[model samples]
Target: MTREPTVAEQSHPNYVKVWGVLVALLAVSVVGPMFEIKLVTLVTAFGVAILKAYLVARNFMHLHIERRYVTYLLVGMVALMLLLFAGVAPDVMKHEGHQWKNEAAQKVVRDAAPAAKVH
Candidate 1:
């Protein structure tokens, strides 16, 4: 015999609507670069990506209904990631070593800076 859903389960979000929103966001992200505008593409792709992640985590993972500690843990993990990236970035970004220099990497950074500033 099939069991009936609890009140909590019945009160859960409309999954179809959530999925439709995700699909629409995906389409926007995919089509964003076609406009060839750097700012628009960046906003659409990254903004949509962050929103999509939130929707999946909040809806599918049910993170919003979880205890406060789970939210703290998630924030802590993200903070740690940012810290780790900051720690590693300087060394990775340094194109000059003790003896050798990474001309290609430096060139790319130099080339991209002006383009980035223009947009």
Candidate 2:
């Protein structure tokens, strides 16, 4: 047997969703300018983007209509994505050390070039 919708769920309040979207957008706008570092700004941007996507999915796509298993799948997928990011970060840090070494070597070469010209 199917169940009926509750009075709260009966009418789709589009304006409420519109306000959510607007508030999320406004939050991004407000937060993005507050950070100066590139990585921080990027993380903040993606956080707000995820918020907006969640609002869209919940209200527009009616993800609320989906079953519990689907919500579990979404949660698992988000966890996997976080794991992927964490896995890649170590490699980036390792490569960044090598980049710093190469930059240091180049600086030494640059400083020596003028000395060589004098000799």
Candidate 3:
């Protein structure tokens, strides 16, 4: 005899539609940079990435129908990670700190600046 699916697995979503959307967004993200516009590139890259992540999380992971606390826990963890990154990023990104200097790192940054500006 076949067993019935549990509640968590019962409400099926149209995964094909979601997959299609994701593929379209991926194509946009890839083609976005070809225009060589900084704003367009940044928007398409980051915005599409965020949308794709949400779609995967909501549709594939079924987070929307899961217990509320599961989503809360995930958000809380992500917030903590961002906070930690914020706290450390300044020191990590700086080539020089109190009583110390990184000549090589500074040189690399200086050399890369012009190339970065061209894009």
Cα lDDT, all candidates: 0.88, 0.72, 0.91
**Alpha-carbon error at 92 in model 1, in Å?**
1.7
Residues 1-119, model 2: lDDT tens digits: 89876533754757676776768786875688587777767766776677777777776656677666877898899999999999987765443363555556566777899999998
State residue 13's C-alpha deviation in candidate 2, in Å. Answer: 2.9
Tens digit per residue, CA lDDT, model 1, 1-118: 8986543473489889999999999999999989989999998999889999999988877778776798899999999999999998977879998988889999999899989999
Which residue runs of candidate 2 sit more than 4 Å off their true CA positions?
A: 1-11, 15-20, 23-31, 34-44, 96-119
Order of candidate numbers by lDDT, starting with the best? 3, 1, 2
Which consecutive 10 residues in model 1 have the weakest lDDT in total? 3-12
Candidate 3 off by > 4 Å: 1-10, 96-104, 111-119
lDDT by residue (tens digit), candidate 3, 1-119: 99966535856789999899999999999999899899999989988899999999988888888889999999999999999999999877988988999899899999999999998
The best candidate in terms of lDDT:
3
For every candidate in turn, the CA RMSD to the true structure comes to 5.9, 8.7, 3.6
Screening candidate 1 with a backbone cut-off below 3 angstroms (N, C-alpha, C), the clashing residue pairs are none
